[model samples]
Target: MRKHHAQQLYDYHVWANDKFFARLKELPEDIYIQEIQSVFPSIAETLVHMYMVDTIWLGVMKGNSMAEIQASIASVQEITKDNQLQKMEKLFQDLSAEYQTFLHHESDLDKEISPEHPQFGRLDTQLSELVQHVVNHGTYHRGNLSAMIRQQGYASVANDYVFYLYEGKAEK
Candidate 1:
């Protein structure tokens, strides 16, 4: 079957995240947890935030209740307590695989969902839109991650969508 627009964007999101995480792992190990005065305290903390949000959204997409979502987030928090970048990367990869499986089996990309949030009130949107929001959220934080790396005088990887496209073509 042909891919939906949201699925394509999600694919790009996973590819881009993998690229950034791989580059992050290549840097000095300390760099991952190095204290920084930014939106987040450190790269490790920022990654944890990214991972938590992704987990929350995935739970939401799967029709999980708020309690279940909170549980999922708490579980991830436990994993991040050690501040290990490798563990964080593995979490991302595992979550990405889950999303891949979800998208693969999802038959209705536009199915309407009403998920109420404590702060944002309620969102009445389609599954596809929620997927898009997740991708956008990831992109925004990846930018923050890139800047954090630069602030520490480290080079950041290029994870633009066009690069993902180019790499796909090159691999064929």
Candidate 2:
């Protein structure tokens, strides 16, 4: 994939994330932390998981091992919906900037990354593929978050890629 393509995908990822977070904020604070039976136990846990995965992929792109990335975000164990939105927002901003910078500087889309997973061992993949995976991963969890919101009797935000396109975001 081209850098511009990855950039557009990342742009949409950020926009969608913001829209989801806005809707999440509209709910009563207690709902954010309420445990439910899903991919994650609660909206807050799902959001934190998304942020942590993004950080992991970003760390891998920067040449850090998965173990290293996990170690870095270990402090997040104590984070909760009650006390972590501000910090998570900062992470969102920083990761977005880092992604944009990575796209700007990398000339090769085919460069390989083989981040080691402790349980699964190592799998070789292209940089551009991983970039796409990160966006897809976020989209999936955001859908989960939406379901959790509705389970709490609140309306969730629409963050579909079509909506992002209809907002006049540049496609090229």
Candidate 3:
């Protein structure tokens, strides 16, 4: 079977996220939880947010109700409350695996899904578009993570999609 565009983008998303997480592991453990005045309170919190949002969207894509998604998010918050780096990394890995399974089985990337929001009203969109949004959202947060790392006087990893392509070529 041919790979869908959404799946390809999701593959890049996973690759970039993994690269960033590995770099985070190389930094001082304390830096992961150091409080910073930015989009999020700390690197740990930011990562947790990313993971939670990813989980929520995955649930949405799976046709889960909002209440179910909220419950799942609450569970994630409890699991990541301590802001431990390893715990957060594990959650991300697990979620990525889940996403992989979902993408593998999904047959209709262009299927329209109507997801209603309390504040934003309703969005009528395709599954592939939602997947793209998730990737874009992650890219934005990774940029925030990069700046936060620099603010802490640490080097950030290069996770650009072009690099992902080049790396694949090199491995070939």
- The backbone clash count of each candidate, in order, is 0, 0, 0
Our model 3 lands, by Cα RMSD against the true structure, at 1.9
- In model 2, which runs have C-alpha deviations exceeding 4 angstroms? 1-3, 78-83
| Candidate 1 local lDDT, 1-172, one digit each (tens) | 5588888889999888888889987899888888898889998888899889989999999999989998997898888798687778888899999998998899998999999887889989999999999999999999989999999998999988789888872222
Model 1 TM-score is: 0.93
Best by lDDT: 3
Q: 167, model 2: CA deviation in Å? A: 0.9
- lDDT ranking, best first: 3, 1, 2
lDDT of each: 0.88, 0.80, 0.89
Worst 10 residues of 3 by lDDT: 163-172
**Superposing all C-alpha atoms, what RMSD in Å does each candidate have to the true structure?**
2.0, 2.5, 1.9
| TM-score: the better of candidates 1 and 2 | 1
Q: Give me the runs in candidate 3 sitting further than 4 Å from their true place.
A: 169-172
Best by TM-score: 3
Look at candidate 3 and give me any clashing residue pairs. none
**Which candidate model has the greater lDDT, 1 or 2?**
1
Candidate 1 clashing pairs, residues 3+ apart or interchain:
none
